[model samples]
Target: MNKELLEKGFIPDEICKVLPEGFQDIEEIASSLHKILANNQITNAVNEITQEKDLSKLTNSELERAMLLYSYVGHAYMWGKEEVEDTIPENIAVTWYEISEKLDRPPILSYASYALNNWALLDESKPLSLDNIRILQNFLSGVDEDWFIMIHVAIEYEAKNVLGSLKKYYLDEDFENKNLEDALTSIKKINEIMNRMPEKCDPYIYYNRVRPYIFGWKNNPATPKGVIYKGVEKYKDEPQLFRGETGAQSSIVPALDALLGITHSNDPLREYLDEMRIYMPSEHRGLLAGLDKFLEEGPKNKVVEHETFVNEIIGEVHKFRNKHLEYAKDYIFDQALKKQSNSNIVGTGGTPFMKYLDKHLKETVPKDD
Candidate 1:
């Protein structure tokens, strides 16, 4: 797809200039503002703005900065520190909520709003966080304008499509004996869609330009250490920042893994990848976990033919994941050339969980008694 194809309807003509050139000092300004919000000083500032009858009273620069503040502060409040409650505090939430609503819901503002409000609706006890799926509903409504957010919306679209196709088999009592070929076909279709995502959104540009501004935690080696928020003194010693890629990178991975019989192997790297699901909306996560259980006890356990078909599906899924890893590698190499940086890129391809599944599938050979 051409860049124009993605850019046409979503981005406004005025905001077209807002990204690369218009926001040169956004990082510095966003960092300073993040600290103030983190310190809970936002109540007064937010109250001041709430009193304004019209947002047009603010200058253009101020309006843009407010946009950045909504993005940064919202992320910091939700994911910055390891607070007991995952929900955003009321004072800060009201400020960003009102600001985002008044601005007609920009991509970042919508993203943060979904994170703050939508997640609380799901049951926390379930392993599969389906709340992530609820957030995708907003994306489907054409709220996301950024290329990065658009890519995620596309991913979730394809993922849900695959799941919807498989729902009938999941509900069927004779699902094991039902033609497994249909499920395989759906998996193949999803793989094709995923393969095109990087083409639609250039990973190189996304990593270098867009990724920096959206990052919450200081985990990315490419950027400086993340900013420290003021409140939650206990977290001062060891703060946790969230990178934008963490949630999007593997949103579909766990669900596919569960379908393909990829279990948690307890490897450190595998665990790290699994932990990223915490950032996902609980609803989608729960759906993945539920599908995993159904496969484990229903289809995979029942018949020899079903086992063979499942193994084939697992192989295809592994190939699909490896393709994504290749894309990551190519993006890193392309960026390295521009920066002339020699840093090694590790963990570029298959996760340990994927590898474990591949090995397990390979080792399971039919035996005659």
Candidate 2:
């Protein structure tokens, strides 16, 4: 397992090859990514996943699949098994319970479901209901110490934020004061619980698991931007928004396959078991132990290798990003900077400044030495 390769060091090249039209500064953009990875604490999280898995059993062809899977596992629970469908909260809680029961672990299913039910109060599709709001508030206030607290705390925090937004949006509309008070109180209680947990104990498992979807908190442009109000009497109702493209699964599958490429030996079962452990929760340590028995037989056919798969996929995506980056550099960034000149950016355009910065970066930082 080459660390630099796994870290997407070759993405820029892939981008350059795929989208040649507007990718002049692709190396520069790639350099910026390297800088971000070096600076951000998230690098530790990425490294942890990489170090834990021994990807020896995967074949060269399977490498892309493994890498894609690694990416997918990060958001497996958030996205549905299929595309464009939201993972229903009730369904997830039920799935967790079933998984837990199979392993003889006590259930923490109801807690997550409860949180989701509360979050639904803020769902823009339907009007906010007072009963749902009160129920959510009461549910949060009651939670103190439970096995589900780890997930519950995060969910409750999210619920509070949603409920707050609802109040803000519908200030003119009459809602129950009791519901608001209860929600506020619950929010404080959740904060207290979160404060007591260890630094490693992140309650936001939902967010972590659904990292890709949650990261880009933007509305899909393909859908209508929702209803707009004009003047005092005119309210234009927009067409209902439906998300057609959620690319999480496709993106993650290739990455996971890349890692799976490394497992080619006579006995790959051990390697497969080792790879799966990274995605397992801390409470399911025994599950990993049980999986050890299954890895006795190694992979039958050596399908792929990690390096080649990663490079290929990186190459493909690099093309896509380079196309966008070229558009940004040649058109959008400069236009944006110029029109908003009174704003932060200062220069003839964005590229020249970024180009200077890129040269400085290449000189100052040795290339992954």
Q: Write the per-residue lDDT of candidate 2 for residues 89-149, one digit (tens) a residue.
A: 3322232223333333222212212222223233546533322222221111222212223
Score every model by TM-score.
Answer: 0.52, 0.18
Best by TM-score: 1
lDDT for position 161 in model 1: 44
The residue ranges of model 1 lying beyond 4 angstroms of the native Cα positions read: 1-69, 72-148, 165-172, 176-179, 218-226, 231-240, 247-251, 288-299, 344-369
TM-score of 1: 0.52
Note each model's CA RMSD in angstroms.
13.1, 29.0
The lDDT for every candidate, in the order shown, is 0.43, 0.28
- Candidate number with greatest lDDT: 1
Span of 10 residues, lowest total lDDT, candidate 1: 1-10
Where in model 2 is the C-alpha error above 4 Å?
A: 1-153, 156-172, 199-369
